[model samples]
Structures are given as C-alpha cells and as structure tokens.
Target: MTTPTIPGFTRHRVRVDDGVALNAAVGGAGSPVVLLHGFPQTHLMWRHVAADLAADHTVICPDLRGYGASDKPAESGAGVYAKRTMARDVVRLAAALGHDRFTLAGHDRGALVAFRAAMDHPDAVSRALFLDVLPTLDMWGALRGVSAAVGFHLYLMAQAPGLPEKMIEAAPEPFFAHFLDAWTRDADAIPADVRAHYLAASAAAVPSIVADYRASAGVDVEHDTVDREAGNKLAMPVTVLQQDWGAALGYHARGLWSAWSDALRHRTVSCGHFMAEEDPRLIAAEIRALADR
Candidate 1:
C-alpha cells in the first residue's frame, strides 16, 4: 500500500525492527531533527513545524509504531508498547536514516517517549525538548484529589485486562477528538482534513494506544523510579515549554521541572495543550534554539 504524501514533504517508511515499520517524512538537509507526535495524533502534527524547519534542517517526523501508516501488530504481552520499546524504535529509525546523534523534540505522548529515549540512549540524543507534559513519575505523583481529575485519561486507560481497548475502539472518534478539541485554545488552528487524519490514525490503533498508556502506569513508572533514585538526570541541555498547569493546580511548575534536570530552561506558553500545532513557529524556534545550544 502506498503511503499518503504531504505536499512539500517527502514520506518514507523505514523498518526499525523485525515487526515495526515507522512511517517518516523527511525534508531539508542539515542536522537531523526527529519529531515525535503525541497520542491521538500521528507525525502529521508536525506538518507546519517540519515545513519551517525543513528550510534549514533535516526534519524527520515519524508515525510512531502503531500510529498513522506505520506497521501495527497485535497486542503481545511479551512485547508491550512500553516507552522503552517505542524509544528504541526512534533510535533505530535515526540510525537507519544515517543520524548517529540528533536533537529530539516531542509533544504530549511523544514527549513521554522522547523522555525515555533520552534516558535510555543519552549518547544518541544531543539535546531534548519536552512540550506540555511532566515526566511520567512526576505526573502521577502530582495527582491529588480533584486536581488530578484533569488527567482522568491516564487512570482510565491504565485499567486491567483489555477493558480500555474494547471501550475506546467502540467510540474512538469521540474519545480521540475530545482531547484535540478540548485541549486547544483555538479550534480553527487545526484544519478539517488534518483533524480527520488524526482521528483515523488514532481510531485504528486502539489496542496499541491503550498498551502505551498502560505501560506508563506499569513499566514506565518503574523506569522513572530507578532513574530518580539513581539521580540520573538529563545530561544534555533541556528546554521545557508548558502551560502553567502546575500553578493552576496549585503546584510550582518551575520547581518541579528543576528537580528533573540540572540545565533547564522553562517557559509557560499562552496556548493550550497542543502547543506544536497551535503555534508551530514558536515550537520551531524553541527547537532551533535547543539545536544551537
């Protein structure tokens, strides 16, 4: 099957592992930059940012594993969609593209996977940018009573057995679109076709998507715990852009982020949850700054 191509961007599928084929879009030429998309969206979320970066850098955005045109496998208990596994997929994808070391940036769910990538393969990633999310351990720890309710999806999808898969598959569009619409401060920023594509990709990958979330509640937490106890913070320069959700929820955002990295530059964007899509120029500028640093 032929993968759909976005104008001004060339699409390619590179096999990262035995069963995993990642659909990636590459453009421009200098220093590679891999952009990972968050949940309920594919690499398509990077369309605008990729276009801008492609003018100066080789912007590679991939549909993570089970999302978008990438290969999808049945949910296997032996090979769950843990962040480590997903991060490895990105690492292999970069090597396959001849990028031994590259800058990494991700938003939302992708940011979580990027975090794992930096943690597991610090040598491969030169710098890191995480948008609109706290580390998995900190996120879970931040929850308290009603304030935690904002992140209901985390707990909901982390259920036992196959309940989340079954429930989400039944009404995937609403489940996926709810966040896309609710989290954005400006709805018109996302075009109709792009929105439909996001819904389609998300709806088709229900089981794997749920597995990714479930891992966060299980294996991902274990990994983060070990890293925290070992005091293994990100060695590379780190920049975090987020809304003041911590302040809104009565927690110190800067203080929490400072605990995670020694060299940290943090900012609060006025935009809502989908910062990359809603404000690609700013996102691209921040990534460029990270690359330069």
Candidate 2:
C-alpha cells in the first residue's frame, strides 16, 4: 500500500509488541502526548490537533493495531483485540519512543482503549481525555430495547459466528465510508488521500476490527465489570467532551462519566460525533486544560 502523508508531520513505524506494529507520526517537542484514533480512522484524524499540539508538545499519534498502516492480524480469539492488549501495545509504543510517562487522549473507540490503558497502567498516564464515549460497562448496561437496537453494530460484530466479518468484507468501502461521512461535519476536512488510506486500512483489517468490537461487547465489558465492582475510578484527572447524546439518545453523558472519576470535567460540544476532526480547536483547548490539571 502506498504511504499517505499528512502535511507537517513525519510518519514512522514502531514495533509496539509481538504481532503488533503501529504507524505513528511524531512532531514538535515537549511533554509527550499520544493520540489514539477511533474506528474507521487512522492517526490522520489528529491532523489539525496534532499540528497545533506539536507546537507545544511532542505529539505521538499512532494508528491502533488493526487500523491505518499498522499490523493487521487474523482474528484468533478475544485476547488479540482486547483493550488490555491494545493498551499494552500503546505503553510499549510510548516506551520505545522514549516516553516513560505521558499525557494521552483518544477519540471514540480510541477513548475506550485509552480508558483501559489508564486502568491497566495507572502510573504511566499523566492525564487522559475521553472523547464521545462512555465507559465500557456503562455503555453496555445502558443498552436496552431501542438503544441496543440502534447500536446494532456492537451486537452484530460481537456475534460468536463470523458473520459480521463476512458481511463487512462484502462491501468494505460503503460500509466503512458511512461512518467516516456521518461522523465528520465537514467532508473536505479529511482530504481524499487520507480518506482513501482509511478505507484501504479498514478493508484489510475487517476481521481484526470486528474482533475489537466483539471484545468490547464481551471480554472488554468483563474487564469494566470487574473494575466497577472494585470501585476502580480513574486516579488521574480526566476531561470528557461529547455531543449531547444523553439528551438526544436518553442517556446522561456527564452523569455517567462523573460516576467513573472523582476529578472529572465534562463538556457537551456542539460538533458531531467526530469531535477531533470536526472541531480541532475545541479539542486542543480541552487537551490543554487537561494538561494543566
């Protein structure tokens, strides 16, 4: 596959762990900040935010294991795509890049992964930003009747039999592009090359990506269950930016997040689901506030 470039950032590949290689772009220089992208997107989602953050911080944005130019492996079981394993990959990636501890932020699926990272490696994450997602347990617990029906993809991909993978592979572009187009408020914000790169990556890693969603619905929820039972709230300061999905969707976003952390600051952004890509300045300001905390 041809390498797609984001202006003002240099891309590099780092071996995060066995069977996992992350495509990362590094820029600027200061306290390290790792940006993890969500579903159907690579690190390119961080283009605008990274450029500005790099001016004041060392911005490390990596395509998560199954996304972008990163290693895509066949689905074996729940272990490979579990947030624990994915979070470990990030820890190793940071250590490889000479960051023993750093601030981190994640959007959508990436936010879930970052939450797990903070839980698993508390000492390593200085601050965390969760964009547009609830804790795994809260999310699943909130799902009911129509709510569960609306999030059909979660249950669909998490099916025991390999149906979602087969279905997704059948129409990769349109299926993947739907999320890309729907999430972003501006279509042109993500350039053609970057959009194509995302499509290519999603097509190649359909199975692994499915495995990730499956794990979220299964083992990842188990992890969150255990954490909640133990009363494990995030020790580090956290900032959450999300759409008013609670009012729109019948779930209280801020109330749910406040239950998970003592030092939590939550805001409802007017942007679409893809806040980082749709509104970088707001995201940057939130990150800066989290950094200061």
Candidate 3:
C-alpha cells in the first residue's frame, strides 16, 4: 500500500524482530521519539504532529504490524497480535533505528501498544503519551449499557476469527468508513484522499486487523490482569489525552489513568477519537511537555 509522503520526512522499511518489517516515516535530529498509529489508519495519521515534532526531536511514526504497509503475519493462536507482541515490535523498531531509548506516543490501538511497551520495558521508554484510550482492563470494566452499545465494534471484532474477518472483508469501505465518520466530531477532519487511503489499507489488512482486535479480548486482558495484580505502574512520565469517556460513562477518566502511572498528567480533550488528526497542535505540545519534563 502506498502512503502519502509527509514533507521533510524520509520513509524506511525497518525490520523488527519476528520477521516483521515496519513501514516507518523517520525525520528530525534531536532526542528520539516514536509515534504509533491506530486502527483503520496508517502512520500517516501523525503527519501534522510528526512534522511539528520533527522540528526539534527525531520523529518516527511507524505503521503497526498488520496495518498499512507493515508485514501481516498469520495469527499463531498465541496472541501474536497481542499488545505485548506489538509492543515488542515497537521496542525493536526503535532499537533498529539506533535508539536504545526514546519518548513514545500512540493513539487508539497504538495507545494500548504504547501502554504495554512502557509496562513491559520500562527502561526503554523515557516518557510515554497515550491518546484517547484506556487500559484493556479499565475499558472492559467501564462498559455498560449505552457505553457497551457504542463500543459494539469491540465485541464485533472480538468474535470468532473467521466470522469477523469475513464480515469486514465483504464490505470494506463502509465498514472502515463507519469508524472514521462516527468517531470524528468533524467528518472533514480526515480529508477525502486520506480517507480513501485508510479504507483501502484497512481492506487489504482485514485478517491481520481482526486478529489484532481479537487478541485484545484474550491475551491483552490477561496481560493487564497480571500487571494489575502485581501492582505495577509505568515507570516513566505519562500524559493521557482522552475524550472524556468517563463523563459519558459515569466514571472518573483521569483517575483511572493515575492508578497505572506515578507521574501522570491526564486531560480530556474536546476533539473526537481521532484527536491527533483533529488537534495536532495539542498532541504535539503534549509530547513536547513530556519531553521537557
């Protein structure tokens, strides 16, 4: 799949461990900072913020495995798409780029991967930022009534493997476009060309994408449960930008994140789920703040 060129950024196919080669956009010259994209979109989602961050820091935005031009390995029934594995891919991707340690940020699905990467390899992540997401355990724990109804996609994608994949493959555009349109407060947040690219990329990666979501319901939860039981918190400074799901779901949003990070800065943004695209300046400023701290 072809990704639109981000001005001033060079693209590379960096091979991480497990034979996974990630399609990454690399630029900048200072401290290393990796930006991970979420579902239904490639690293292109970070175009604006990445460009801004590149002015002062090394900005590396990579298409997560099973998305965009990245390798889509078949599921090994071992939760290969689990955030733990995906997180490892990020760690190795950074190391391959000669960064033994780096600041990190992720949105949506990528946020989960960032969270895991921080938890599992605390030494490798200097500071972490999560955009519009909750821990797998908190996510499941918070779902009830209307919240559960709105998150139907989570359940739909978590179903038995073949069915979800088959259904998504049947009508790729509408299925993929649904999230882009529904999640964004402004439909124009994603332009026509970018939306088309997302739909096409998502259609091609149906099986792997579904597997990623499937792993969330299984192995991802198990990992989170273990972390919770162990009383482990992220060892780095963390900043979370969310959509005030707590207000909508009748819970405390920032309070939820505080449990997982000792150094926590959580705020609810007014943008849609695609906060980076909707408000790139805020996202970039937040990352810069984390780096400054």
Candidate 4:
C-alpha cells in the first residue's frame, strides 16, 4: 500500500540546507503558509488542518530536518539539530519554493523552530502560531520536582551521546509509542494507520531524534538565552495555543509568551497536546485568524 499523505497535496524533496533535503507536501494557491510537525510524527500530522487551509491558501508542510522523510544528518556537533539551523532550513525552503514571506504554524518541536525563526528572521516570517510548547529557555526553568516527571523523556534524551541513542534504538517502537499513546486526547484522532506510520518513521530515526533532544538540553537553550538577554522579540503578530500546563507546572503560560511578543494572543485549551489532530477545525480557524492579522 502507498504511504498516507495529505489529500491533494503534491510531495517534493526540497534541499534547504547544505547536504540536507526536507521531504515536503505543497498544495493550494494564493498567499503561503508553512506547517511544521511535532515529534514522533511526520508532516502528516498537519493533514486535516493543512487540507482545510489549502482551500484558500498555499500550504507547505515539511518534516523537520531529522524527522519523517527528511534527511537525518549525523550529529557532528551541537549545531546540527539546533532549532536555529532547522529554522534557517525552513526560511530557505520557503524561498526555494518561491515565497519570500509566509505565515508559519508549528507544534511541539516544530513550534520551537518556528519560535526561533520568528525571532531571528522576523522579516521573512509575516506571522506565526506556536502550539503546545514553551520557549527552550523558559521550559528548563519551568520543569522541577515531581511535576517534572511528565517530561522524563526530555531528561533522558538530553544526556550525553551514545547512551541516549543506544537506549532508544534498543526498543525504538515502544519508546516512541509511549508518547504517541500518552499525548493524544482522542485515539480516533491518530487512527491506526497514522499511528503505525509515526512509529515506523520514528523507530528508524532514533539517533537523529536523540540529537534533537540533546541539542535542546545544550545548544538550543544557549541560542534562546542569548536572544532573551539581547531583548530580541518577534516582530510579527503571534498566536500561542497550548494545553494549560501552567497551573500544574506552576507557571503562567500567557505570561511566558508575553515576554517575547508584543502582539500576542495566547489561548489555553482543553484539547490534548496534539491539538491540530484532535480539533482540526479550531486549529484551522485559529491559523486563519492569525494569518489574516
């Protein structure tokens, strides 16, 4: 059977960085919007919302550097998987696709990349939506004590090389499946085929995936922290959608976002972490609202 993809979208292997090519699905017309996927899944995670937006705008969904059909380069250094590098791949991807500027929407890890892109190259990103994530600098500060248990994987993958990659590769399926099973609020949202696709793809990407998380614990935090101290901020209109982890995590989600955005609309939702899949219509509508602004 052929792989499942967003209906009507055409796929392309676009090289956005040196020796790195991102597998992307591009469709629709009019102004452009790029959708970036979260962990343990491919761009297919944006299928529902992407299809909805394609009816009115050009939609481009690309698997991040180390995920899905994209090229997974060996982690020669901390910069390899840093979101800044990944974000540059995206800016170049849009330019290579003939768009000088586009609205962006990213979830989880993807959102973190989008967050950096908006900050570093504000002129190229017209507007953005970041879903279910805290900026890296803020995330480390937020996790503490027993409440931090929910993010055990973060600490696990953050360890120095060799060990983290070996531990995950030993039983990749179950290791990846744990998040797939735990994060979704509705099982029907992923379905069986999509879940299988995510597991298979993630299983094959253990090393690169571990490098991504490891960068989060090291270089990624450095980039965000340096920018934070410089007082760099997003120049575009910004929208943040998150499952209210504030009360349980002892931090205010809106307050954290406000520090980085002057034009921010932060919405706390009941939908699971994978809000794009669990509530596609709301996700699509929110993207439309933000893109329009």
Candidate 5:
C-alpha cells in the first residue's frame, strides 16, 4: 500500500527506545515544532497544517510508536504503552532530531501524550496545543452516563487485553474505518487515498493499538492520579481546542484544564474530533499563537 506523506517534507526513522524507531516527516527550519497524530491515524493527519507551518518553523510530524510506520513493541508490561512512556518517546524523538525542546501539538490520543509530557517534562515542552481530548483523569471522571456511549471504543479497548484485541483484529479495517467515517466534519477532509492509508495502518497495528488504549485504563490513570494528588501542573503555555463534548458529558472543560495549566486557553470549537484534518488552518493558527506566546 502506498502511504501519503506531507509534500516536500523529508522522512526519518529515528530510534527513541530499545528496538523502537518512530517514522517522522521533517521539514522547514526555524524554531522547531512537533506534531503528534492521534488514534486511528498517522502523521498524515497533519499534512495541511505541517505544510503551512513549514514556511517559518521546523515542523516534525511523527507517527507515534505503535500507530503508523513506527515500530509497535509488545505491551511487554503495563508500563510499555503508558502515556508516560509514549511521552518520553516523543521527547527522545525530538532530542534525536537535534531539538532539545519544541512546541507541541497533538490530536485525540496524541493529546493525552502531550499532556503527560507537559506535566512530566515541563522543561522540554515550551508550549502545547491539545485538540479534542481531556486529560485521562478528567476523561474518566466526565464519562458518567449515557453520553459516554460515544466513547465505546475506549471501554472496548480498556478491557483486560485478549478480548479487545481479538475482537478488533477480527475486523480491523471496518473497526478502524468506523472512526474515520464518524469523527470528521467534512467528508472531503480526508481524501480517498489518505483514508485508505489510515485504515491500512490502523489495521496493521491492532495489537499495539489495543495495548496503547489498555495502558490508559491501567498505568496511565495511575500516573495521572499521582500528578493530580501532587498538585503537579503544566508549566508551558497551553491552548486547547475541543468540540463541545463537555456540555453533553456534564463537566466544565475549561475548569478541568485550568487546574492543570496555569495559562490555559480553552475554545469550544464547532469542528469534529479530527479537527486538524477537518479544520487545518484553524488548528495551525492556534498552534502558532500558543507557540509564539
């Protein structure tokens, strides 16, 4: 299967951990910025925004480990796919590419990783833009009643491992395509070729994908709880763009985010969950605004 990449960007396979290498598209040159793709997608989601940012900033879009062309290590232990681990992969990936620190942007699952990074390695993430997600702790706390059904995939993946992986791998393409079709505002946002690429990549990484989500249910929450208890917070300037899931879920997103970040700008956007793809210009503008501040 032919994979679509950001045009004019060069690709890199940089080793970030033992037997793990992340595939990244790197382009432009100035201050550095790293774009992390969310679940059911690869770095291709950032194609439009990355191209636009490349004019003045060095943009690095990497397929997070276990998602796209990146290596998918076994769950190994509960810690393997933890957001802490994934966040470290991001930091190491940036360091390997000659960036000691960089502005951060992540969508969906990637947003969780960016949140962990900002809290754990404050010195490494100067600013952050999180798209359409709450922190793990806030997410679980908010999913109280019927409205949580929209996140059935999370419950499915958070199961005790074997079952969810078997069920998803049984019909991987359809399973992955369900979100690709359901989570976007514009049908044309993801072109046919790009859609095919996402399905193929996601289908190929079912086990690792399930493990990643499984970690969220286990070790990730523990890590987040520790931070919350310790009163740890994000030191960087942070901007969050999200669909109005908060209203339906019975939580105040701005309040939750404000607790974690000293400087937070939360916007309730009209776009769908895949905002970077559906509204790339707005996403890019928000990233630039936060990064420049």
Candidate 6:
C-alpha cells in the first residue's frame, strides 16, 4: 500500500520480536523519538510532525504491528495484542535502532501503547506524549450516554473472536473510512489520497486490526488494572493533549491522569479525535516540550 512521504525520512522494517515486525520510517539524527499511530491509520499519521521533529531528533514512525506495511500475525489469544506486548515490541524496536532511552508519543490506540511502554519501561522512556486517549480503564469507566454512542466502535471491535474480524473483512473500505471521516475535524487535513492509503492498509489487515482492539478490552484492561492496583504510574514526564470531552463525559481527564503520573501536563485542544492530523504543529510542540523535559 502507498504510504505518506516524509521528505527526509527513509522507510525500513525492524524485526521487533518473534512473529512481529514493524514497518518504520526513520529520519533525522539525534536522540531517538518513536511515534506510534492509532487504529485505522499507520505511521503515515505522523508525516507532518515527523518531518518537523526530524530537524533535530531521530524520529522513528512505526506502524504498530497490524497496521501499514507491518506484519499482521494471527492472534494466539487475547493477550497477543495486549498493550504490554505492543509496548515490548516498541521497546525492542528502539533498542535495535540503538536507543536505550528516548522520548515517545502515540495518537489514538497508539497512545495506549505508548502509555504501557512508559509504565513498563520507565528507564527506557525519558518522556511520553499521549494524544486523544485516556488510560484504558478510565476509558471504559467513562463510557455513558453520548460518549458511549461515539465510542461504539470500541465495543464493536472488542467482540468475540471470529465475529469482529469476519464483519470488518466483508467491507473494509467503508468500515475503515468511517473512522477516518468521522474523527477528523477538517476533512482536508487528511487528503483524499492519504485516506485511500489508510483504507487500503486497513482493508488488508482487518483480522489483526480487530484483534488489536479486542485485546484492549481483555488483556489490556487486565494489565492496566494490575498496574493500578500495584500503584504503578509512569515515572517519566507525561503530556496529554485531548479534546475537552471530560466534562461532557462526566470525567475529570486531568484528575484521572494525575493519579497515574506525578509529572503531568494536561491540556485540551479544540480538535477532533485526530489531533495530530488536525494540527500537527500543535502536536509537534507538545512533543518538543516533553522532549525538553
């Protein structure tokens, strides 16, 4: 599938672990920063911010296991796509690239992975930026009324094994295109060509993509709950940029995150769920601030 082009970046595949390989676009030169894309999209989601960050940082934008050109192995079980494993894949990918410790950022489902990475590998992540997502537990707890309606996809994807995969595979384009269109504030931000790439990549990886989301409800929650009970929080500085959905959803987004992070900077951005695409400069600035920490 065609991927977005970042002017100074060159694409490469990194074998993160057995049965998992990440298709990454590597660029620039300096302390490494890995940017993970969320569902229905790939590393291409970071095109604008990656190029800007590439000016000083060794920016690594990788399609999380099941997306883009990355390998989409069969899910052995629910834990297969758990954020814990995905986090390990990311840590390995960074270490293989010679970065033992670095800054990290994720948008959407990617943000979930990045959060797990920070909690599981504190020393390895100097700082983390989470875009448009809450902790998985908090996310589930906050669902009600309109919020639940908007997050219907999460429930749809978190279904029993064959069902979600079978349904999405039947008509992947419209299924994938639904999110690309629904979540973006400016349709122009994601050009028609870019949207096509997202649809194509997602269509080809429906089963694995569904498995990834399914894990969030099962193993991902188990992991998060264990961490929460153990009083485990991200040691690194954490930056959260999200739409002001907390009040509407009957939540204090910052309060929830503050419980998981001592050094937290939370702010609201008036964009749709795809903040990175809607405002790359703003997202880049947040990363730069976190990197400076």
Q: Global CA lDDT of candidate 4, please?
A: 0.93
Give one digit per residue, the lDDT tens place, for model 2 in 220-245: 98998898889888889998988876
Per-candidate total of colliding backbone pairs: 0, 1, 0, 0, 0, 0
lDDT tens digits by residue: candidate 5, 60-164: 999998999999998889988999999999999999999988999999999999989888888899999899999999899889788999899999999996999
Mind sharing the TM-score for model 6?
0.97
Output the worst ten-in-a-row residue range by lDDT, candidate 4: 1-10
**Can you give the TM-score per candidate against the true fold?**
0.96, 0.95, 0.97, 0.99, 0.98, 0.97
lDDT of 1 by residue, 77-193 (tens): 634577888899999999998999999999888999999999889999999999998899888888878988888889988997578888888899999999988899989877888
C-alpha lDDT values of all predictions:
0.87, 0.86, 0.90, 0.93, 0.91, 0.89
Model 3 gets an lDDT of 0.90
Worst 10 residues of 6 by lDDT: 1-10
lDDT of 6 by residue, 45-149 (tens): 899999888888999998898888989888887767888989999999999989999999999899999999999999899999999899999999999876689
Candidate 3 positional error at 140, Å: 0.6
**Residue 31 C-alpha lDDT in model 6:** 78
Using lDDT, rank the candidates from best to worst: 4, 5, 3, 6, 1, 2
Candidate 2: C-alpha lDDT: 0.86
| Model 2 poorest 10 in a row by lDDT | 1-10
- TM-score quality measure for candidate 4: 0.99
Candidate number of the best lDDT: 4
In candidate 3 the C-alpha lDDT for residue 208 amounts to 92
